[model samples]
Target: MIFVNAFLVGGAICVLGQILIDVFKLTPAHVVASFVVLGAVLDSFGIYDQLIQLAGAGATIPITSFGHALLHGAMSEGHEHGYLGIAIGIFKLTSAGITSAILFGFLTALIFKPKG
Candidate 1:
């Protein structure tokens, strides 16, 4: 049940991204950015919460989830520490992702040979 729902939801999201790229001729970067922004906007309106409850990691494992995590962090911290908390929240929530990305990228570059 839960696994099936997660697969269906995650598949749907991947299909949507593929459709956007194939039919609309959008760049992959554009599609990724659009999805993330959309997720953030949806979170602002509380729509994303329901989706998460319904889909679990299907909603939390995408690039959109990154945005949701960011917005959620900011909102939570903003309530406690005011405007400054927004920045702090973003940093706290996203730092792990950003750090891992940089670390892995650097490691991959070091391990692989680049073309001239």
Candidate 2:
């Protein structure tokens, strides 16, 4: 069930992106940025949490997720660290995703050894 939900929601999101591209003539970068801002705004309104619960990584693995992670991290850190939290909060929030991407890429290269 979880896998089904994730795949369906993720595919829907991709379909939406394709629609935006075809109908609105948006670029890939613009679509990504729009999602990030939209996610941030939705998070601010406390709406994205439910969608995240419903979709899991479908909602949590995109650039929008990055914004959501940063905002959530900043708020939590700001409570404990005060003003400095704003500056470092995003890195703290997104560290897991960033580190995982780097590690996975390194491991993949070591195993595959692809060359141009």
**Which of the numbered candidates is closest to the native, going by highest lDDT?**
1
Model 2 superposed RMSD (Cα) = 2.7
**lDDT (Cα, tens digit) per residue for candidate 1, span 5-54:** 78988889899999999999999999999999988999999988888898
Q: What lDDT does the true structure give each of the candidates?
A: 0.89, 0.83
State, as a TM-score between 0 and 1, how close model 2 is to the true structure.
Answer: 0.78
Measured by TM-score, the strongest candidate is: 1
Q: What is the Cα root-mean-square deviation between model 1 and the actual structure?
A: 1.8
Least accurate 10 contiguous residues by lDDT in model 1 = 87-96
Q: Which stretches of candidate 2 lie over 4 Å from their true place?
A: 100-116
Off-target runs (Cα >4 Å) in candidate 1 are 114-116
Task: Report the lDDT tens digits of candidate 2 across residue range 1-116.
Answer: 77788888788878888898999999999998988888788888887788789989888866777778778888788888898977768578789888999999999988996587
Q: List the residue pairs that clash in candidate 1.
A: none
TM match of model 1 to true structure: 0.90
Compute the lDDT of residue 51 as modeled in candidate 2: 73
